[model samples]
Target chain A: MLNSMLEFVPRIPIAEGTEWVTEWLKEKFSVLFDPIKEHLGNFMEFMSEDVLMLIPPIIFIIAVALIAFFISGKKLGLAAFSIVGLWLIYNQGYWDHLMNTVTLVIIASLLSVIIGVPFGILMAKSKIAEAIITPILDFMQTMPAFVYLIPAVAFFGIGMVPGVFASLIFATPPTVRFTNLGIRQVSKELVEASDAFGSTGAQKLFKVQLPMAKATIMAGINQTVMLSLSMVVIASMIGAPGLGREVLSSLQRSNVGTGFVAGVGIVILAIIIDRFTQNMNKKKA
Target chain B: MPVIEAKNLSKVFGKNPKHALKLLDKGLSKEAILKEAGNTVGVNRASFSVEAGEIFVIMGLSGSGKSTLVRLINRLIEPTEGSILIDGEDLARMDKKSLRRVRREKMSMVFQKFALFPLRTILENAEFGLEVQNAPKEERRKKAEKALEMVGLAGYIHQKPGQLSGGMQQRVGLARALANDPEVLLMDEAFSALDPLIRKEMQDELIDLQSSMRKTIIFITHDLDEALRLGDRIALMKDGSIVQIGTPEEILVNPANDYVERFVEDVDRSKVLTAQHIMKRPETVNIEKHGPRVALERMREEGLSSMYVVDSKRNLKGYITADDASAARKNEIGNLEEILKNDIPRVDKETSMHEIFNIIHDSPIPVAVIEDGKLLGIIVRGSVIAALAGDAEVNIENA
Candidate 1:
């Protein structure tokens, strides 16, 4: 009887409904989406080809190593790791792909921060906003990275822009969540103290909340960068260029050696980015 | 006019504050209102006025609404009903911009937990109030430095609050408030987080600072002893209502209710009671108008061992013992001053019983309570003990 009752309930057409909504949005908002695609695509292209590629790989590697050294308080470990890791990626003939991947991840993470922080602040300030946004954030975080590519392509066509769209959806939640948590976690007495001194809302945010929440926000941004990096291989399916493309082609041909080297390159990049950002947070301490 | 006057100010913590207020007006008790309407009364119809340059303290146990009352004064916690007047300007009715301006110019607060920004240097923390006011950078810096110096933290301006000890951090909190040079200071259990020794030190320093600054202060504490030590007048709260408001001596001497009486029962009375509270009307001899025979006669009539001799203007000259007066009469000394003993201990009328204890222990006679060289009264060992024993009806006229 239970099985018969369960079978009587028809399946919900969630997929069909979602497809209709996506198509309707695409058809109706082409004017808005088109400009964003064109301008954002051009900007990311200029960043990778014109700005980053213009620098000699050796100089870029040395500069990053030096930054790592100073940021890590004259520690030899991170600086040495950066030099060795970049040299290996360079020797493996994936330096251009590395740069392309770097551009995608950096832009995605930066955009996430720009968008996420305000949303986080809004969520922290209002219970209604928090209630509305929390579920959306959860959906973005839990939905498979592949599921976003369809909307990404519909919105931005293909290549690095679409890649950015997909990676942004995947990576933005941490920054928003962390920023909200960080602001909310500030001691009640501190908030009262700020209010008692008659601090304007903006003054309290800048002077007390943001500065106190810096480390937590930094940790969130680090998570965002890592999430963006992880999306690169998936993003390459939409024709986004980078070490992710190399890994994709290698996977298709079953070339284990080539895929392994590309994977190693991504690991090296992740560690370098993670260590640099973590060290920046520690410098304040 | 009072510097800060709160008239029927109340704070109800719940979604339906109007309902809670109605219940409050209906005379529903705090717990009953909370049970019926799910509303907690934070401060219920609290009315008080703080005079300029005086420390007005609000004291209560935890959850008694003293903290909420202090917060309501500055509108950090907005009142659910009634009004607050700052120098006759209605604070509760002011718009946000004007309220912020008042907060910047009129008052600042110190917190129990020393809420210094952990990232900012002590100088930056101290300058926070001025910075909020948009003062010129150099002016803020100078004021912050001077304020820090006043709090004895001038040397630690470059260091962050995390590196400082709790007491020092609280000093920085005090400096931040002082740097604004506000007309009033709101200190909410500011020293409650410190060790007893540091708390005493901070209290002494605050008293020292207050003597010179003379800013109107609204202080909150759960400690009876602290309220007595620091407050010029104290308002005691119980279950979100002010049970009594009076000078520390009046509160100690005549509690308004059983709750207030119980609350102050355990307080160390020696610290609060003074020479004036415990002193007796001194039996005396007019040495300027009367000779040794008169002094001896008065002593015999009073059945006293010694007599405090005062001049026509009531200036304390000295005391003459019965034996000395008799010896003086035998030796033809006409004046009592010739044989008067000048070794008696003299204390000001405001001297605490704590200090009187030390002086009285070594004295053979009663400690003379004098003001400006005139004898007002005398504190005998019996009077001090009687006061400490909570004997409120000690006969000042009998001796």
Candidate 2:
């Protein structure tokens, strides 16, 4: 085997080269990561002072009531009202934290969309592109949250930037996978019909395939949002502050009341955001 | 005389044949081509032509490449070998942009599954072709509305494809095709997926649409009955190759072989074929005031095989078979309507001997094609057998 190696130049082992590569990637990633986090922190901290603001949550609660009235009836409406009442009882003040979380989710989701859609298009169009990207998505999805933090800390150091980056990474697969899946799932008969009508490749993709994929892609968006929310708790370990940080702080100090209260607030936030996004998806469908 | 013609247009699926012009851009090595060869010969050098505004149908079982043939005409599937010329323009020579323009402006298609864009409303779906061609928004919308009205889906403008029944969805598909105002309309089993009743409704709608539009149509189907009912000319296919191409009368009365005969064996003769193929020339008949039933009895009395059903003016009326005349006699035969199996298989004076063979075989009984309710002749199994066996001369008469 060693003599056969002479026929071709010997390649270095991955372990020998990966550490330096990792450090280099880490340095390159942080160059722009820290500043964004600092700016996010400043905005979030300022917003925290006005966290007691209640108008939006109250409105949201009412909207939930209206929607629930139609979906599951008055009983569901009452259930929605009680959920709102519980958020109020927690004394965490719903508005500002919810807004900050919303900002994070929106930013993360938008970034995922930007990266996911083009990547999906490329993957769907070519087998080689799919071979390279699909497995990476599988890894991203399967890897533990703690493992994600290693790259996050090494690359963006610590804070909101790292949180957002982690969130984007975690939430990306659905957007990419679902978009590709929906496009692929469209009937071949329809594609042929469109082609027969003299639709060019671009026209076929955008008008026929993309339009048909709407509901499916929306499902992907919903999945991305849900995944991004899961990153909030893990992101707090990187000093990313908000409900996640509060929950962690209370748990560390053995303050069950504080931990439970903050945890409940986070759950309420998730339900509200999930419900709203789900409704948006329904309307689009 | 053909508006569209394919000279030995063979579409083999394998990567390479000795003389096959490679479909894709880069040429592969013979070894690699051999290794990666795809299976199935989709279109086996199919050669047929359609006259301008003629409803030419291709009928086959699933995977017999009937769908492949229609798609190939528009070059939706690039042929592996041979040439396809549409109005003397070689489709193979057209570039991407030119091909697109041809498709958008010259050709349109109706699909087996309707293929309506569910996201868009009915009106928008119809306007898809115009949109692809960059038709202005308002103009496309107006044209789409008009096309929808033509298909009788006028009130369904705002409805999504999912909101409509299968028949309505197919109508929308037709409307979309018409929206392009295309020169040639390609339909691939457009009504195959609908219910029997709905299929009939759509077929009638299509016949009406085609009559008024006069677009050259290339319709594909597995249903022999549909081909007979709808085609001006039917191209019977098997194993990716055309077995025969002729008028309905020629196909029924003089099928090319046993394969086609089996396919048309159960067909309804009165509904499909005409009364012209089987009509016998009157040999010294002076009685002109007789009904078709009386004419049949006269032929029987004179020991003739068949007799012409002519009017007082000595023009041919529809012919009646001896059996048909006798069948009508079970009840008291009084009038011409009572005695005559008035709806016999009829052919044009111009119908080829080939079509007469298929339709007769397709029908439940031997028949002839009629022109203006006048029989030219009668077709029995023997005439078709002689034609296919290549023995007897085809005594085809023009009306």
Strongest candidate by TM-score: 1
Task: Judge the docking of candidate 2 as incorrect, acceptable, medium or high.
Answer: medium
Across B89-156, the per-residue lDDT of candidate 1 in tens digits comes to: 99999999999999999999999988888888999999888998899999999999999999998898
- Model 2 lDDT on a 0 to 1 scale: 0.73
In the range B179-292, model 2's lDDT, one tens digit per residue, is: 989888889898999998888777778888788889999999988768877888899988777888887667766678887776666443322222343344443222345554
Q: Candidate 1 chain A, which ten residues in sequence have the lowest lDDT sum?
A: A276-285
Write one digit per residue (lDDT tens) for candidate 1, span A1-285.
889998896998999999999999999999899998999999989999998988999999999999999999998999999999999999999998999999999999999999999999889899999999999999999999999999999888999999999999999999999999989999998898888888999999999998888889888988998999999778999999999999999999999999999999999999999998888888864
lDDT of 2 by residue, A1-285 (tens): 898978696776886576688788767866565666677656645554454344456565566567655544334744565456545733565345555565666667788988898788787778899899999999999878677787777776776667888888888999999988888888888888789888888989999888778778888888888888778766888887667777778878989987887777777667655665666676676
All DockQ scores: 0.85, 0.68
Which candidate number would show the highest lDDT if scored against the true structure? 1
TM-score of 2: 0.75
What DockQ does predicted model 1 obtain?
A: 0.85
* Candidate number with greatest DockQ: 1
